[model samples]
Target chain A: MAEEVILLDFWPSPFGMRARIALREKGVDFDLREEDLLGNKSPLLLETNPVHEKIPVLIHKGKAVCESLVIVQYIDETWGHECPLLPSDPYERSRARFWADYVDKIFPVGRAAWLSTGETQEAAKEEYIQGFKTLEGELGDKAYFGGERFGYVDVSLIPLYNSFYALEKLANCSVAEECPKLVQWAERCMQRESVAKSLPDPHKVYDFLLVLKKKLQPQ
Target chain B: MAEEVILLDFWPSPFGMRARIALREKGVDFDLREEDLLGNKSPLLLETNPVHEKIPVLIHKGKAVCESLVIVQYIDETWGHECPLLPSDPYERSRARFWADYVDKIFPVGRAAWLSTGETQEAAKEEYIQGFKTLEGELGDKAYFGGERFGYVDVSLIPLYNSFYALEKLANCSVAEECPKLVQWAERCMQRESVAKSLPDPHKVYDFLLVLKKKLQPQ
Candidate 1:
């Protein structure tokens, strides 16, 4: 049976990009169904992910897979003939999951850093930077978090590079200055067709956030 | 080469119980080193889990795997000849992970419900109960979360069943009344030797919490 793959996503979401990149990695052809998350959420989106009611839902062969990391793992497993996202060894797989989990946490902290103010924003910024620094420490002297394999952790994190431009403008912070290695690693990732194609323009993301910020907190 | 396994844990911790249960499920005997998480932490504990510096570190052949869910997955992968905790199918695995992730989140809300006061406690209790009710809906006539197999989601949550007595006393609430199916599921899990032996007496947990609470918030 021919597989019918579809991704219910918002273009700006880093989480969505992770699934897109993973699908690309597996050479899977998928339809991207953009959802209006803020204004009017689609019933399909709600129906697929009833729990979170959130996106990056990968509908493959009629089964809906929610959660970006889980979706990536699913994509890897389903079409695992080539370009494996997670390592074959159990220990390596665990290590990949651990780092991906760490990357998962950064989203909230990074969002808080940008969206909040006063001590809350400052503290979030500090913690977010600390998280990146820790990732840097793990990433020490290796091409990727998987050490020569551009795999799970790399797919988990590279999407955030799209948000970096928006974050720098909004938060007045610089990951490039703090974690140059991460930037270098991301640039290296961009060289790949999968990553290069998946990520949207950061400036567009920044503009959208600007509109969102005004709608969220008016003057 | 003979396999050397050890578990670094704290008795009252549900997270620690997960690792112990997974090991027991795998039928792999290991030395259990109880960590003094409150007092002086062992150097072994610190060294083994330098990143989190937290317990439920499963050391197999001298390499440490931290995080209870990750540790469970590791145990499942390593000693997977019998009593497989996670399903083989990728979609089923993803579903197990999604539910387990939901269970992981209930810990903080449940903790807040028990530890905090007034409005904060009320809100946490509400959210925690809601989470359990959702689990009940998902369980809906199933023999287990995995539908007759006590798998990853089961292992992830059965540890929390140990905390029910402590939680009921501390929060003045009842899982039995709110989530009857969930309570029944817990009882079913309790019948498993892996779960029965791994969890400490809840009354002991309650006493430990009282002492720790006094230390944390003194009069």
Candidate 2:
């Protein structure tokens, strides 16, 4: 079996970061191909993920696996018994998967809320707040979403949490204040060497959002 | 381990039906708790799925798993080596999961186009058309999304296909004409005994849409 793995990614994409973190955590060495979102994508990315033509396409042994969550699962399964992302227990694995799915569904919509204005933005904010609150409540007193250890759920959730401060600033609402437990959880996740090292700076995200808001606003 | 497994679901929800179909396919005979989405939700539903409070909660030996895709995976994992939803091959499993995730993300948004009116509806229609075209292009000449066998991807996609006629009728557009191959693929799926038995009447779905549209319309 060939061990050649290449990751096509952009720096700010949380989805791409997930694959990077997973690879790093597993102590697997792979080639990282940085993509320019503004310019034409690499031939490798296009060929690898013909359907979506999106980033975070993990080419393992020349086979492309698209979608961050799906790629994460593939990595876990392929590298099973070597720093497992998923739990060995069937029920526990299901629970971990459930949280990852929830994060995938809600995070994009929540992030979009910060980019819009007026009624649409207001509605998005309400939904976003509700989602964060639910996450906070679910966390309760757990050290991580996967109970004590930092597993798949924590990896999935923590990436999105990287944008919370920036999103709060852009929306003019404090997600941290509203969902304290989730905020605390985010902070706790940052303490992990894997998370701390993998995540990009929060201020750069804020700057990016400011530019995005300017570009999106009516002249 | 108990032989009994219960599914909390609503008939109209494609998500719920995914669980029902998976259960039936697995030959797992259990209790079906039909939830009334418009009226009062059961305490069990709330207790079981505290985060989402959504249907398609599969309770096995008192533990509940939410999210349709997650539940499907759970069912497959729990069941002994019989009709497996996921392929044993890691690469094949990744492909199956990719298409399933694609369908899960796009189907509802496409359905929303049918349920809207005026400019909002037009925007949704454009989005739906693009998604449909992509889906069709992806299918090419494959018998199922997972090639020959009607595996997890086929099961995930068929429910959305069942609603296509209803959606086209509601939106006053011919999806079949626009994406002939996809329509044919869907019809092929319907020919299967498992799918034919599991799905509701297509006309009934259109009738249900009329009621939904009326309720959703501004007074």
Candidate 3:
């Protein structure tokens, strides 16, 4: 029997892009239902993820999978015969998951850069730049975080490309200038059909961020 | 040849306790090297986990795996021969990982409850209590989160039992009174040798917390 796969997602969400990219990479056909995150959440979204009530819930064969990384791992495991996302070796898999998790852990630094101002903004930007250096060190001339393969860490992080321009403008720092290799790496990722299709226009994302910052800061 | 396993950990840490429980559950013989986190971090700990330098690093045959949850997952995948921590089915595995991630997510609320003071503390306590209630709802009369087996979610969460008394006193709430079922489930987990041996005495943890709070927030 063919699998029924449905994704509950918001367009601007990096997390949703992860699921989309993974599904596309795995060659899985899924029904994408755009969510009204700013307005009322759908009954399906609410029911599917009663705990988080967040987007990027992948419903496969009637069971809901929440958390983008977990869902991405699920997609990989289920359709691993085609394009394997995680490495087969246990140690390599642990490293992949580790760096992917690092992406999540460092997000607050970037977030605070945009959402805050003055001393707080300066501190966040400095922290984010330091975090970027560490990430760059990790990248270290590898074509991809997966080291020559567009796999787990690539899928986990490339979504953040959508917010790069907006963050650069708001945070008053150029990621391209700060981490040239990372920017190059992101461009390499964007060239892929899966990532190209999964990501929205960077300009559109910037516009959305402008509205969001005004709404959130209102100053 | 037998695999050499060494754990870089702190005796009081819930995170460290998680790694210990997983190792115990797998019946893997490992040398436990306790770190003086308050003092100087050992050279091995520094070398093994240069990224986080945090406790609960599982060093298996010279490869270091940092992050408690990641280490636990590694242990499960590496020695999945007996007492599987994560389920075999992809969906079940995703759910297990999701709930474990959720446990890590809600932890900041509990930490805030103990760390902060005044209005912030009150807010954190309220948030922590609300989060606990949600966890209790998830528990829903199950013998364990894995339903009759003390598995991933069990290993992920049971370590928090170490801080229950300290959290209760500092936050001005009773977990036993707030979520009776959760407390009961914790008690059930405590009966197991893995848990009993892993956790420190509750009063001792509370005393440690007193010292920690004074050090962190001196008046």
Give chain B TM-scores in order.
0.97, 0.92, 0.96
Segments of candidate 3 deviating more than 4 angstroms: none
Best by DockQ: 3
Ranking by DockQ: 3, 1, 2
For model 1, the local distance difference test gives 0.88
TM-score of model 1 vs. true structure: 0.97
- lDDT per prediction? 0.88, 0.82, 0.89
**Which lDDT value does model 3 have at B123?**
89
Candidate 1, residue B110: Cα displacement in angstroms equals 0.8
Interface root-mean-square deviation, each candidate: 0.8, 1.1, 0.7
Model 3 residue pairs with clashes: none
Residue pairs clashing in model 2 are none
Report DockQ per prediction, comma-separated: 0.82, 0.77, 0.88
**Model 2 Cα lDDT, one tens digit per residue, A94-143:** 98998788887788677678877889888888887887787777788999
Candidate 3 overall lDDT versus native? 0.89
Clashes of 1: 0
